[model samples]
Target: MSGEVADPKPGKAQRRRLSRSLVIIALSIIAGYLIIQFVGQIDWGQVYRSFGHVSWWQVLILVGVLVLRQTLNAVPLATFVPGLGLNHSLQNDVAANVAGTVTPPPGDVVVRIAMFNSWNVNPVDGMAGVTMNMLNFYAVRLLAPVVGLVLFTVAGLERHRVGWALLCALGAVVLMLILAMVLRAEDWADRLGRGAALQAQRFKASADPDKWSAAVNKFREQMSDGFTQRSTISMLALLAMVAVDSMILLLALRFVGVPASALSIVLVIGTFFSAYPLTAMPLFGFGVLDAVLTAAFVEESGLHYEPIIIAGLAIWRAITILGPLLAGAVTILVWRRRSGSNLNLWGSKDTAPTLSEA
Candidate 1:
């Protein structure tokens, strides 16, 4: 009798590993290329001189602002994840910031999920906390332009690029409305889960429809309960965090001897915030953001201080990106040592279990 052949399962894990390696290699190549491009555009001597102009007091203020910004960013996590202390939240935020800088979209989320899992948090709860915090952060970012426009008009300043700002604000509103509907309506969440499961199945991806549906339902329930809790404080903290970051940017410009007006500063900050989604892919949009911000500042201020602008941006990135990255690396090392474990960057290997196993 002819026997039916069983599909090989060992090949599946091998394929996954191979695909992951390929992705890592591709990302590394892209990052290296972007770094080279950025370096080639800078004037090293001018940048070095600009650094000398910044006072120690300014550096201290920048450091303080960065710390406050990070602390504020952690509030939403503490709010969503009951019993998650501020220290844990800050640690998670810093670590995610480091990972997200190097990885592509949703990299921060992956790192946070892995960290939470290692901390013994329930998977669904961890996801809920991260999702809520992300939604709050984006909502504030999208709405800021509209708020800035209103303030600018009241302040009697020229509203440059108002049209683009309005369009982005409207889009943000629409997205927020859709997210609200999805979170509030269990049926919508269920439909989304079912559609996702169907798509995964069609792609021959490993997924369980029942599990997906259950997870979605659980997420909705958690979100609903969490929102009903004292969430206003968390939302406000998120807004404050954005404001603090903008202030830091404004200070950076001042340190560069830029005679930018308050209105110009607001608009420039708004532009930077709006351009985040575009520039976020390459190391937290390192080179791309610097270029965009420099162009915007030049266009708005009508100044040609290219070297100074570049230097200011370099300082800003140093404090925001490099500082956090170093802190996060140290945090990881300390945690591993304290736990007496040799976990990888994302956390213990078992923390992020395979999809099939999950």
Candidate 2:
């Protein structure tokens, strides 16, 4: 026993759990306080009245736009897996959207990967496709702010907000530069992975540098292959999807009697581009997203119809978040019944079907 190290204490694990619980409680309290404040400021009667202004035909159009957006979303996946049908792709997208509502960054990707595995798709190819799609998605979002900045300058309005647009443009450029380095610079991805692993180790996480490096290199290679194979079509589809989705939001505002103008359109797109990162939050960023969008509507668009803005936001959330969540749940249930597989969406034993079964 001379050189034996002392066993780790059970109390340390319990203490870590307690610390996590306390942090969660503190965050919950803060969020609850904010929500109470937001609710107190709103007039429910006006919000209800605003909803009556939106016509049933307009609601149909909004639903159609959302359907089209979802359809376009599956294009990149179909490109990645040539044999995959559009219906399956749509189901996967819905499943991803559902998972993303509950989890943070890359939750959609996690669900997609699991779905791909069940469908007998190669994991590397699946990851490559998802990464390429996400890259294009964010690229378009970042670029939109720049376009809005140009539009604003041409319109001779909101010159003061140019700095914010420029900042977002710079962020986009930085992201592109990092992507280029990962794909084109030999060993750069590996080095970045090793550095990340080193940082993780400092936080008491177990990470093998060599393994991380290898994975990064593989990811880069797959990305390179995907780009070479389907970049043009995928990028086009992604751009179109973003544009249509933004239009959906604009239409929502219009339905609620928010007068549409060139400046308003530019502001709407720009505001969405800026607040896009909020989607990484839980429940598809429910309260946080509404607050950000409401602020943007008032400040960016100079709209003072607080009730209309709140109502429009509710419609937007219904179309984008709640609808997909419901559809995804149905899809999962159908898959379970048909496959008779004991699949778990959350972390548990994976019941992904094999190639033969799929």
| TM-score of candidate 2 on Cα atoms, chains taken together | 0.76
lDDT string for model 2 (286-356, tens) is 66766767765765445357678778878987888677788888887787677565655543223333323
Candidate 1: regions farther than 4 A off: 1-44, 100-120, 226-232, 260-281, 346-358
Candidate 1: give the clashing pairs: none
Residues 4-76, candidate 1: write the lDDT tens digits: 7744553565467557756755675565446434434546678678888899999999999999988998988
What is the overall TM-score of model 1 with all chains considered together?
A: 0.77
lDDT score, candidate 1, position 23: 77
What would the C-alpha RMSD of candidate 1 be, to one decimal place?
6.0
> RMSDs, each prediction?
6.0, 6.1
